[model samples]
Target: MPEHIDKLSISVVVPVYNGGKTIGRAIEHLLRQSLPPAEIIVVDDGSTDQTANILRSFGSRITALSKANGGPASARNEGVRVANGSLIAFTDSDCFPEEDWLKELVKGFHSLEIGGVGGTVRAASGGLIGEYVDLHGWMNPQCARDGSVLYLVTANACFRSDLLFQVNLFDERFRKAGGEDTELSVRLRSFGYEFVFVESAIVRHLHRRTIRDYLKNIANHGEGQFILETLWPQQRWKANRRKEIVRSAAGLGTMLRFYRSYRRQYDRKRAFVFSLLDHCQYMARIWGYLRGKRELSSSSLRNPLTRDPSAVVYPNENLGSSSVLVPKV
Candidate 1:
């Protein structure tokens, strides 16, 4: 540990929606961290289920907040607003962090230049879809060719609270649970702050079990990709219809390669199924990309002058009235 580590305080923020069944377990795991956080904040993003009741059951163990059905980005922004720690760690309600997760994440912030640190995600359950997701390292931090992290997945990531404030927190325009983290990372990188990846800081995530769920996740990612490209045109490459078609065509070869790789470990039947799902994933992503393009175009037409992709809005600036922290019962 660095000499300055003792001066840092950490807070764990969990943004959840309709996660009544798993939120308790996630909180439990957080509480058992080897390097316990100074505070644990869970933001309930207007869940229609028994999520509120479950949160209440946690009592004073966590600081629970309730708000309208804003996306994960908005919910996370709310959590960051009230966090009392210098380091804010984020994880999903469906994730279970290991005992040393926080310790390892904190260790990565040994210097002032590191704006954030992220860990790897492992699948909690073992099913066909789960295995596929784990095998492909689906939720791991996306890295550059030289091993620099491009973006940290929020499923297991920690960032400096001050840096987050400087970036104006998360972009609420992302009305879903994807791409907002990537955009934040890009903005953070712009400040010349590096991000470290701590392989030992592991979190077990409950992956999408069914094929329908998996395909939906892939499609949502496609939409997020479009949003990122629009928001940071200079940083992200814009894909045209020609590029999209070419990418889709090339996906066939990728699928075959994945199938061969899977066959080496699993049975032929399972490999075939995995390859088929990969094809479906490609189609779903393309559809989502096209849909996102149309939605963005419509949004631009509706508010041509007011729309500013570069602007970062903090939660207190606009969302203070709409979001409220529920007092501990």
Candidate 2:
């Protein structure tokens, strides 16, 4: 058995960039954690909004850091730098955790071998895209080979401070949100670190509610995924291509299976409607992924600085000239 939970020290890190509207609420919910953190640190990444003023309202209740607006990964890395606890917990400024979120997640430590933990993320809004994401298991936890979690998103994840460093922190090159967290997860898993999915540790995500916001989110995810593919050719599906002669027939069979599965989960009418929308999202992801691939190749040729022996252009960030990571690879 593991030692008592009180023996552990945890710190919460919230990265804010123009999060004036929700940062206060997030902090409010965080302050209510059953197992309070050693400290709550919020890093303001060059926000042009009233975010700075709002954070000041919290006064000494929190530690606030101001820096040139780097992407979430950079901001998060900065928070981890100033953190003193044994565990570095992360949550976006827009996400609010339940009062018991910390208590529930920390329980996973009883397993002793777990190096990371992820919590369930539920939609706080009922907008179309948000509702679809909720029903589609967007934040559903996956089981790893050792019966732990396969991946953990920073939106509701905590890492053993030492382990986070072992994986080299979040990829700052991912100026966007989607890929950096997964990239870190992939690297950590490669090292055989165990991460658990704590169902009781829950946070409510204010997901994109409109078609435009949803599209942007999916495209970003696609781009990030392509970046992953570029960096890890072994993971690129295109790298392991196979010839499927009967494409149309195979698609039909897959559709049939999906329909059957959906029917079992919901009424036929509802299933059909949402399934169509879901496919739209999936198609968008494919488009983004392909676009990312092409753009990555173009960028690599256009920006030879990426070829520098000292640093790389973050493999596939494709942000053109924005940021780069110092990788030994």
Candidate 3:
């Protein structure tokens, strides 16, 4: 069992940029946690707005660090540097955890062999679209003793301090808010680390509120896949290609089976129409991934933040050119 929460067994990192609007609420929630973090480190990834002022308002209740506009990965890495806890936990500036978030996280440590763990993430939206997405299992916990390539989401994840270094930190190369977390998790799984899934350690995510936001999120997923391709090259391409074919086939087979069953009971025409739509969406995602590969090849692939004058282009936007903000303690 995780030894009783010591002086500070966990270091929660929250990377903030342009979070002026909602960051204060996030911090406020963290301060109210049932098992408050040993230290709540917020990396201000060079915000150009009231984000800095709001952060300052927190005073010494939190540790705030400022750096040039590095992407979320860079900011998170910075948080890792200054963290003095045995366990490194992460949440976005936009996400909030259950009061027992830390307590439940401690519970997952029941196994000494578990190197890292993730919790359930529920959507924090009351809208119809949000309800639909949540129903589709966006944050549903996959109870697995070990992680598969399929089960990865960084928004509600935590890692042992040492295991994190073993994976070499989040891939900073992904400058656009996607896929680095999965790539790292996949890599860890490859090394035989068990990625325990803790259902009790729940986190609620404030997902994109609009269709535009959802589309942007999916497109970023494509771009992130592109970056992963560069790192693993042959393996990435092969794995993705295999997944595309298998999932595409399975998706088709599933629809066909549903159609046959429905045809025996009701209208064949309706089943055909619904099945077609489902297949089309699957095909579209596959096509998007292929296009993303070619597009990624053309991307300058240079992180604009660490570079020169380009960083000033969006001084007002605190969103990491690469990091997606989740709630942080």
Residues 206-266, candidate 3, lDDT per residue (tens digit)? 7776655665666676667766665555336576766764585456686786567656744
Give me the candidate number with maximum lDDT.
1
Model 1, 31-59: lDDT tens per residue?
A: 99989899999999999999999999989
On TM-score, the stronger of 1 and 3 is: 1
Comparing 2 and 3 on TM-score, the stronger one: 2
Q: Lowest-scoring 10 consecutive residues by lDDT in candidate 2?
A: 312-321
lDDT of each: 0.82, 0.74, 0.66
- Output the TM-score of candidate 1: 0.87
Off by over 4 Å in 3: 2-8, 140-151, 233-292, 295-329
Residue 131 of model 3 has an lDDT of 51
TM-score of structure candidate 3: 0.73
Q: Which window of 10 residues has the lowest lDDT sum in candidate 3?
A: 311-320
| lDDT for predicted candidate 3 compared with the true structure | 0.66
> What residue pairs are clashing in model 1?
none
Clash number for candidate 2: 1
